[model samples]
Target: MASMVWTRYAAIGDSFTEGIGDLHPDGTPRGWADRAAEALSTRAEGFGYANLAVRGKLLDQILDVQLPAALALKPDLVSVSGGGNDLLRPGTDVDVLAARMDEGVARLRAAGADVVLFTGVDPAGSAVIRRTRGRVALFNELLRATAVRHGAHIVDQWSMDVLRDWRCWSIDRLHMSPEGHRRVALAMLESLGVQDAGDWREPELAPLPALSRGARLLFDARWARGYLAPWIGRRLRGRSSGDLVTAKRPGLSPVGK
Candidate 1:
């Protein structure tokens, strides 16, 4: 009888994979990649994790740096998240972004990676950057086609609206909170067909607690003034925070002293 071969995984992307705001105790990448790595380590015992995610990286930047590193790993499973930065730039040519992604995917496939999972940009409605929705959708479509062409898998990160709900986002309204990252990691585990270890906790939905009318109004105003307005202004200025949103200060009232 032949023994089963396990896949060695490598993750490549930008802040999302590096876990920008979700810092580790040492302030390193604590995003979905780390969580997925931990889960896979426990599940597969010997699966390798090579996470190469830079902060504020564009698609071209990833192709230039991280792609080569991932190829060198000769990973059996490669997970990628990108394209958000390309959407941030004004007058970005979608065709160019698509071509770069296609080229990167081709290189990874040629490197003998059997399973490649590409993540889509989260929906803009749940994100601080409002202008990116259209571009994100387009990039996701391109990524899906590219993955299919390369015989890889697709992890629809954008379609997980359950995680996009306000409860899952951090104070910045951009990056995923710890809970959100956990959900995203679980989804990746499912997509990779990796079973969870004893430590893996399943995500659950709970009913929203009733709030006083004044509390609701305060929350709504804060989200609008703090998140939405700044998001719009940044986009108009042709700037992007790139998964890094300044968290709201604690112990401050809406009308601060």
Candidate 2:
């Protein structure tokens, strides 16, 4: 870690950062952020890491709750991810969210931490999700500007063509599968200037088995009913999947400790 010196690193975000779709053997999420910490810890001795990300959290909750707690740890490096959950809600003003994000990130920068931000993925691979492509693009631009303004590092998920595959996503189509999380971890390490961390840009894996058009239609229908419908219902009811959940790694501790 000659080029890096962050001894205490903290992550703050939602399910994406929490690694919801990438479950460990014990069924706990072990996502890219955690993998990033492990990689950094290997390079730098006694590195500390904390993740305050919870599923179904909005940008507001991330900043309101998690951000302060992360700052309390006085982390030298922090990754801030949000707005994907906000994008799912109806009438979510991308501009307003970006503005709030700007403020929150500004605070992190003012705290003398090297901050990292992520742009949302290009959902062109998902037929149902591609409809929001324009909105995601606009939000990503604002995030780029915010990063430039605050001197924060930005991981460009939008440019990850490797992620635009069915194999990279979980069955629910909302979270990254194990393969996706692996490449994303590589991407984060690359952004941090970690040499020889592996090429995240490389596409790998066999193609999914072909299914008849009728079967595909039925699968989509089931997915919509089983996952999408309830998600929308939760939004309408003002409930969140994270209501009963708390941060998985709430405090900064030695990596893998």
Candidate 3:
């Protein structure tokens, strides 16, 4: 099995893997998994790809729901990334989350698929998610150790300074923008020893205009009304954004070619 050429690639996780912010013209999510699949297909003429990821899923939900399907696919490579949703909730224990995630990684490896794991990204657009930076760091440490123990490749998102830029995030302040997803796909391929399109890291842009205190407050209010409030409502009702959503790419098939 050459590191650069995988015949089949399966992705399992939550919104990030599902491609929330990067949407097609018809509104279908086309995320990093899709990009990686396209890149892999270029390396291998008939590459197959499946993405069993849904938006707003927790680490545990992904383990219970998506992992089984992924194992059944018997892909040569599997990308497993989750835990951010769990960490966002109040009083969530990241260590326990990490432990559960570690078990999932071990299971994937035991199933004989080369696994790729990811660390949570620090949010630059939201003060609320920004506050979780310390907790996210702790989880990333555990994730790194888990990858090492399970012989998995880690994407190391925590080490990427490009993610610190606010431009990388979508307006919802939770998911990455299309450009952000593109960069992540390139990074993932590079981590797997696969040559990608070009440099994932681009030159920095000029800083955004400084907002007055009143204008900043108004912007925060709009964000709360548009995104944060609805998210909280769903949490209170014990629902998820992915409640009935199915996998975007449910079966392995040729991509790019």
lDDT values, one for every candidate: 0.68, 0.90, 0.87
Off by over 4 Å in 3: 1-3
What is the per-residue lDDT of model 1 for residues 37-139, given as tens digits with 9 covering 90 to 100? 6766654555666676766677887789777877776777777777776786678988788888888888888888755555554665542366677787787
- Provide the global lDDT of candidate 3 against the true structure: 0.87
- Give a tens-digit lDDT track for model 3, residues 30-56: 989898888788778678999999999
- Find the candidate with the highest lDDT and give its number: 2
Candidate 1 residue spans exceeding 4 A from truth: 1-7, 119-128, 196-202, 207-257
Global local distance difference test of model 2: 0.90
* Sequence-dependent TM-score of model 3: 0.94
Alpha carbon lDDT of residue 231, candidate 1?
71
Candidate number that wins on lDDT, 2 or 3: 2
Return the candidate ranking by lDDT, descending: 2, 3, 1
Candidate 2: residue 156 Cα off by (Å): 0.8
> Which one is best on TM-score?
2
Output the TM-score of candidate 1: 0.75
